[model samples]
Target: MLQQETRDMDGHYEFVTVSDEATIAFRRYGTPGKPRLLLIHSLALDGSIWTDVISGLQGQAEILCIDCRGHGWSSRAPLSYAIERYADDAAEVLDKVGWDQVVVAGCSMGGCIAQAFAVRYPKRVSAMILIDTTAWYGEKAPQEWRARAQKARAEGLASMAAFQATRWFGDRFRAENPRKIQEMMEIFVRNDLDAYEATCIMLGDADLRSALSGFHFPVSVIVGEEDYATPIESARQLAKAIPGASLTILPGARHLTPIECSDVIAEAIAKMIEAAAH
Candidate 1:
């Protein structure tokens, strides 16, 4: 449903069709056998959301940045959107790419997808890093998420660009990188309204807290000190849910740390790569 790639990055785009008939889009980067990574982007955004961070992790990590169904070049599935379906799509993509296992990392909606992947395809994931996301949005999440979806349906995704900008980055990052902000805004407006609403309702009902204790792989939780979207409490809860998981909170950063705290994120991935090798 999205147009051809518009980001400034040079990732080689590829496409694959899952069992459900939705065509998914992904980009390959780095070399093989050097810490395989799978990066998932936030809601209303595509895999290119990791453009800046992917550049930082290049050469050292073989990575796949996937545009989840209905988000980017991926098809807007005729069925309703669900986190588990997205996870299954990731696994199918892995089969096509020949990746046996990968360090799954996701931000916001992607982070929720990462959690679902860990639960549904335990053998397919080597490690996981959850960023700026939560296992659940809380007691009133269903109502709140539905309301947000209706607002978008009525007013269009463009109406929330300013809000998304504020939640995604801090004043400093916004002032320093206006073009990236503009691109993000564009992506938000380009989303399919129906798919966007379904995805929101899916997220509203998504609950992975019960499965966190079952996670066998190494889990790392990262959050920005100023991230009110998921917030510090959410990251703390996630960290506590998984045994042996480490939590890192970046100072002065907001929800999208992949852009503002890319160096720190790269360091975290390096550490995970080392841990997996041992």
Candidate 2:
């Protein structure tokens, strides 16, 4: 069973200077003795999105949730964004904490980074958990998404927030969770347009499908039941492609299921970890 937090929980937050100039902000939750689980956020969102999931897993695992470079509290870098770069940043965070092995989990863009990490540094990852993402870039993404990236590069983040909102959430979620929708929009708006545009280009260019099949570690794939962005069909294909991988569907969930349905997501991940222990 998933552990429930009956009382308010607080965690310690700090910054690690990864590349001399760039400082990555991370929040540490749970005790020092527990196994560490790294949580990566989706594009336009920060580590805070994992709050709900963390609440359930805190009793079982220590979580190190990072705000990727160019998003949230992390310092922007002059370098162009890539999944590899994000993986390197994650490695840096783990190095700082002295965790040689960990369960790496990511959502959407974060999931892409996790795959990159597992492929590049297999020795560092004990297991991998991916949510609502693909190992390869979309075969034919909406042309308007590319257009929006270009617009953001030229105009600014404010002009791109609406498109982000539409792409990140399903219609029903946007209708029912107006407050959450508005909050996410604000985060996207807060992002530096150049960085966001660069990240979008990186996402479009990433293709790790070939490398995914080679990973020997335990892998679990998850998706929202109603995820239209990546879709459950695509996630199922990913599950089939990777060896010994299992897939779970979060019911009544949208693309933002990690945030909207954190309790279930956290429990699913916790259960996966427990099962892996044997």
Q: What is the C-alpha RMSD of each candidate to the true structure, in Å?
A: 5.0, 3.7
- Over 4 Å off, model 1: 1-9
Measure candidate 2: CA RMSD: 3.7
Per-residue lDDT tens digits for candidate 2, residues 1-278, read 96644323466668988764588898888766666789999987799888879887867887889999888999874764767878989999999988888888899989989999888898887788899998776665434457768887788888767776776777777888899888888887888766777787777778888887887878899998878777899899889989999999887676777887778888877876675565
Residue 149, model 1, lDDT = 91
Poorest lDDT segment (10 consecutive residues) of candidate 2? 3-12
The Cα local distance difference test for each model comes to 0.89, 0.81
TM-score of each: 0.95, 0.89
Model 1, 10: alpha-carbon shift in Å? Answer: 1.6
lDDT of 1 by residue, 1-278 (tens): 95433333477779998998889999988766577899999999898778778787766788889999988999984664878899999999999988888898999999999999988889888889999999999999999999999999899888899999998999999999999899889988999988998999999999999999999888899999999999999999999999999999999999989877888887887788777767
Give the runs in model 2 whose Cα sits over 4 Å from its true position: 1-8, 140-145, 170-176
Cα displacement (Å) at residue 67, model 2: 0.5
